[model samples]
Target chain A: MRNLDEDTITQAVLARHTGAPDARLREIMTSLVQHLHAFARDVRLTEAEWFEGIRFLTEVGHMTDDKRQEFILLSDTLGLSMLVTALNNRKPPECTESTVFGPFHVEGSPEYPLGADVANGARGEPCYVRGRVLSRDGSPVPGAELQVWQADADGFYDVQYKGEHGHRARGTLHADAEGRFHFKSIRAEAYPIPHDGPVGRMLDALGRHPWRPAHLHFMITAPGFERLITHVFRNGDQYLDSDAVFGVRRSLIADWVVHPPGPTPDGGRSEQPFYTLDFDFVLNPLAQD
Target chain B: MRNLDEDTITQAVLARHTGAPDARLREIMTSLVQHLHAFARDVRLTEAEWFEGIRFLTEVGHMTDDKRQEFILLSDTLGLSMLVTALNNRKPPECTESTVFGPFHVEGSPEYPLGADVANGARGEPCYVRGRVLSRDGSPVPGAELQVWQADADGFYDVQYKGEHGHRARGTLHADAEGRFHFKSIRAEAYPIPHDGPVGRMLDALGRHPWRPAHLHFMITAPGFERLITHVFRNGDQYLDSDAVFGVRRSLIADWVVHPPGPTPDGGRSEQPFYTLDFDFVLNPLAQD
Candidate 1:
């Protein structure tokens, strides 16, 4: 404890932390310190670089307020969010895989009935999204509650807007008696994440783009089933192969079929081109306690 | 790249970063990703735990401002700062060792002539600190500039005060022709770091104290020598064995000799008890570029 050098310092830190009352906290912090120290040693980090990291982190913190979360964005961009998602959501092979739950998901979104216009004046091409909630055995899981949200064509969520912008392109709905759900919303479009902050600067310096593929976020919950937080990415997005957040999955990708001005899924007439998407979600049973 | 699992996501992220133009940035990022992913996998970090960590980091960031750097404090408490210091500053067997450059050192401290009262009305027992600057071979390195600072008896730096509290217990002075220097300042005392923030809460949760051993910080510099950032710790401080920041080194400890009310080191009379500490600093030559 008195004369800690580079190699012995890690053990000293772990020794100091052995008194943590919470076993889980102790374990987590132990691994965290070991890996963090190893990272610094492996890089032979200089004082200037260390100070730069400190400055970067402080700026990230200062940039964070009630509306934006720069820390989450940093984690997402680093692929940590995806890794955590993968570790926590190990599901059956047939079930829908989960991805990074982007920072845009909000609680108490305006509730809409099946097939209603959940987009509610958001800017994008008209789209009809149809989906069914099913169990791993392919049987319907009726009345499963679905929380859906997505960015507008301009790549901004309702919260991202500075002023009072009513909720758009996001809402809550429930599957029908047959576990089928549909909603009229905007078509998903590729867009860059908020890149005007420190994280954006980091991405630029790293020669990496901040664009996430077009995707619709979904969070579904039902009785006797595990909660699902995932996204339905559009098939032909150029950024699909290099999603900034590493949130794209092959199973989550589906086609947004283009249609000429014609009858919609709800039997409504359309003068302009629109789109339709049909995808099914399979829920895993909750683990037995 | 699109279907990354927990283990594979690390490689995908590293691969995406391969386009970074800077070789140093590429190397640092590669190691960072590897260690970061290993930590998550080692802990099997869950979604809830990951979210908690994000929130904790956000709080740490929010707590930081122009004067307070919670991130640096976090690094210090976790021993990362010391590890970085040790890694960057590898002195010879006899040269003085470097330690954590605490967050409180401010630039532009009022300069003082030798034997001047640098405390400037700060509260603590009067102490005369005499020290010399020498090379590893024990030859004097005259006129070495020393920047010194320490906390008052209340365990608060001048910057910690909310209002206009002038600089106290800190100043800059230069060694004389014989590499000898002495200044009037306050005796160091064990004190808790700024603990009203998230880091404090974390320390409490880990069943650890927030107190650092009594010590005075010093940064010495001269031509043709490496800059040295170190501390002169009191020999018998209770917290020395378990400093909250892991900043204590055996060689840095020195005796603070107590004296009765009598003539002081500056040939001045003192009606109250005082202390004296004599220390020597050895600097290493600058590394060849």
Candidate 2:
């Protein structure tokens, strides 16, 4: 038994468990020990510095609320978020590119019919998004549950409105027997990342940007195939090359063509204006661990 | 000018600004935008994950207090602590190696006179550490301030035992005109990184060990040189190969050789069993930021 000091404290604590028989856990712990110890030694840590590091982490935990998660944000800002996502989304092609399932998906979004309006009262460049969900073999996946969430025309989420409204342009829709789904909404705009927290402070200290490109999020699932979480980026957004969260993919970019104020398929007020958004999604089989 | 949705709410709230930007603020914002955007792109983040990340970060903030900082712990556990220390401590040879401060060391530690016993009531191997804090030129820097804090015999920092007794094995010690400093305490012991937080959970998930090797933390400063935050590792700790925070350096290891516990021939308690712990610290001048 070693007495309390800097290194001894770390040793006693880390000694509680040896490498797990499980190879994955063993690898992670091994790498973690090397990196963490190297970090401590590199700085020649002090008691005050150690405590300061603890206090910073404590603040990260306390800053959390129903709407925010500083630790996850910290991880995201530090490249861990993408690393985890990339690590997990390794299915074969023809499967829709799996992206991160962000935290703001409302359990109960206003459900719309097969072709009902998803952007009830929003204003922007109106676009008709039509899509089909299919298995990797190209068979239409009917009755597939699809959750489509996007920012308003102005690039903000409904949750940001708090008391004003909830889940705007965000809701659940189901594909018909043909696996065809269509809805009307406005194009999303690029937005910045959170910068008022410690992640932000660290970023500020190091000098970095936080802009994400425009995109619409979708989560589609069927019983046999895997739950597909993905997004379609606007083809030519200025920040496409430098998305804040790195969600862009070659296949996910859509062809959003402006069609002027043409006649709606149903022949409503034609001159109001609208755009056409078309894309498809392919899902892989589900693998539960 | 866009409306908020769940997807964009994080950015909107994070970028909520105070209008005009000064030079420093602009510089901060500019760099923040780049790195953050790159991080997002580097990982290809999505909406659900983005909100979840926000929520995680919010909790980190909620966990902060004067006694602890979860954010720093997150940074320490994540290797950011050592990264910052390394980037900050590019000193020439002979300077003490800087390291991450752990999660303790509160204010109000009683100041002790030179040659006074700092071991309090804890019992273990006795060691007398004598050091001269000098500049790079080898000249003794008179009137330098030194703050000494260490763990107890049980591999726990004095602050960890809060409510049992206050400021045990932690306090400030100043150097005499010769840049000389001495104190009597038991040789420090090995301990663990705090394992009761999200950091612990991360380690568990990663199958990582939290043990750091044994070492003593030191923060030495004088009028001209940079404030030196460093450590002296116990030579034989088995965990040196894998420091939890990556803080170990080849030069930082020290051997507090075991000898019959005895007082110094300088007319102190020659009867008490004690070991000799001696070292010298040289500091680089603080660089202008």
Candidates 1 onward: DockQ, in order: 0.88, 0.13
lDDT, residue A272, candidate 1: 96
True contacts kept of each: 0.90, 0.15
Q: Report the error of model 1 at residue B135, Å.
A: 1.3
Evaluated on chain A only, model 1 obtains a TM-score of: 0.98
Candidate 2 chain A weakest ten by summed lDDT? A1-10
A38-148 per-residue lDDT for model 1 (tens digits): 999999999999999999999998898888899999999999999999999998899999988898999999999988999898999999999899999999999999999
lDDT of 2: 0.67
lDDT of 1: 0.94
Interface root-mean-square deviation, each candidate: 0.7, 9.7
* Top candidate by lDDT: 1
Model 2 over residues B129-161: C-alpha lDDT tens digits?
888988878988887877777776678886666
Best-fitting candidate, measured by DockQ? Answer: 1
Residue B4 shift from truth in candidate 1, angstroms: 0.8
Per-residue C-alpha lDDT of model 1 across residues B1-289, encoded as one tens digit per residue:
8789987999999999878999998999899989999999999998899989989999999899888899999999999999999999997989999999999999999999999999999999999999899998899999999999999999888888989978989999999999999999999999998899999999999999999999999999999999999999999999998999999999999999999999998999899999999999999999889
